[model samples]
Target: MDAETLEIRTIEVTPNAAGDASTLPDLLAQVPADERITRVGGDGAYDTSKCRAAIAARGADAVIPMRRGGQPWTTDAPGVDARNETLRAMKRLGRTIWKEWSGYHRRSLIETKMRCFKLLGERVASRSFDRQITELKVRAAVLNCFSQIATPHTIRVA
Candidate 1:
């Protein structure tokens, strides 16, 4: 999701068996290579090494909060240093303060957008996987259109 535009930049409809963290890499891969991604934000569920590594691979800062009682990674992995640094910051500043400092609250906007998406239709009418994907994409497009129309354009006058 694009924070500035409130658009669904990419969407992936995975099977129920696939976990959010596990499917994150595939979602990140869908993003065009040329697009510059500065930050990837998500809930604690996305704090896994795989998700962090995927974000790091795209050269984006991970804004995912660590899970409660999470331990630092013992391996020398691509995202280990950043994740550990975030963990240390969380420990030092405290979770609430760290979240405020890191702008984690911006994630709530995405969550609200998702809720609105779900409100459009909780269940997809299509039975086939391909159709389901198309259905979701169409819904997202419609939502994006609505967001674009509703958003106000403001100018500052001195």
Candidate 2:
């Protein structure tokens, strides 16, 4: 998702049991190559080396939290190394403060969309895989339209 625009740039529908870390590469691949991505923020599940590598390849910072006792991968990717440094700083600054400083809270934009989806309908109306995919795409489009119309734009003079 584009944090600034609050737009869903990519969506990968995976099975319920699929690990987020394992699916990072597929999701990252969906991001357009031309897009200028500065940082990729995710929850602790995305702190693995593969995800870090993909983020580094895009020349972006991985604003993901390390798991408990999670050590940095021994590699030369600057972004990965920077993530490790962030882990160290997290220990000093505390996770909550670090999240505030790093703009991790913006991740809630996607969460808000999820909430909207749930509010609109909790269950998939279509049972078939292909039909379900089409249904979700249409639902996302409808949600985006609703968001565009309902979201108030405010200009800050400060």
Candidate 3:
């Protein structure tokens, strides 16, 4: 998402406190502790100790990769040994994804979706935080509805 429109965040931002990072933890607190979340995938910025510990407390696996320059912990977990093999396989798969010679590339499909949102000419006429949030929700809802309409259905006559 562009800096102008949306920030990619795991937390939802209400209009009252949009664009404010200070409100995130308080918003997170409002979510019940008992609710079970499975794997959470995010970039390393969400790698704060508190966030990690909280996820562990809830019995959820954090799919987050370890950040650089940290002490590597040694633990014997199943499927953990496959990392080296996966990197080897990535060499082959990564080449085709780039359409030429290979180097690891971040997937751009999510960025493409964000670009589509911007291109849709969604109304951002009001700079007021409430209006921006209201428009964001409407845009998301409309996008989902359009996906439902655009999906093809197949029928077979007996």
Candidate 4:
């Protein structure tokens, strides 16, 4: 989701067998290479090495929270530094303060968008997987249109 527009920029529908975190890389890949991604925010489920690496590859800060009782990655990997720093900060400032400082609460915007998407329908009407993917994409487009329409316009008077 694009934070500024609150629109789904990329959509990938996977089978029920696939984990949500596993799709993070593909979603990032779908983004145009030239586009500048400043930050990627997600839940603790996205705290995996692969997800972190993908976000780092895009030159974006990962706003994913560490898992409960999670330890620092043992390997001196490329992405571990940022995760370790987050861990240290979380330990020092406490989770609530760290989250506020990191702007992690922006994740709630994504959650609200999902709730609006669910309002369209809880389940896809299509029976086949291919059709289901198309259905979901169409729904996302509708939501994006709704977002564009609902956005308020303002002007400077002074």
- Tens digits of per-residue lDDT, candidate 2, 27-113, equal 788888897789888999888777888888888888888788877666776466788798888888988998898888888887887
Q: Candidate 1 — number of clashing residue pairs? A: 0
User: Which runs in model 2 stand beyond 4 Å of their true positions?
Assistant: 155-158
lDDT of 1 by residue, 98-132 (tens): 99999999988999999999999999999999999
Q: Write the per-residue lDDT of candidate 3 for residues 1-158, one digit (tens) a residue.
A: 21222333233446544443344345445557775555433344544455555555555554433344433334444323332333344354552552222221232444555576677674576688777767776776665566557657789999
Residue 4 error, candidate 4, Å: 1.4
* Stretches > 4 Å off in candidate 1: none
Question: What is the alpha-carbon lDDT of model 4 when measured against the actual structure?
Answer: 0.93
TM-score of each: 0.96, 0.87, 0.49, 0.97
Give the range of the ten consecutive residues with the poorest summed lDDT in model 4.
70-79
Evaluate model 4: give its TM-score. Answer: 0.97
Q: Superposing all C-alpha atoms, what RMSD in Å does each candidate have to the true structure?
A: 1.1, 2.4, 8.4, 0.9
- Which window of ten consecutive residues has the lowest lDDT sum in model 1? 4-13
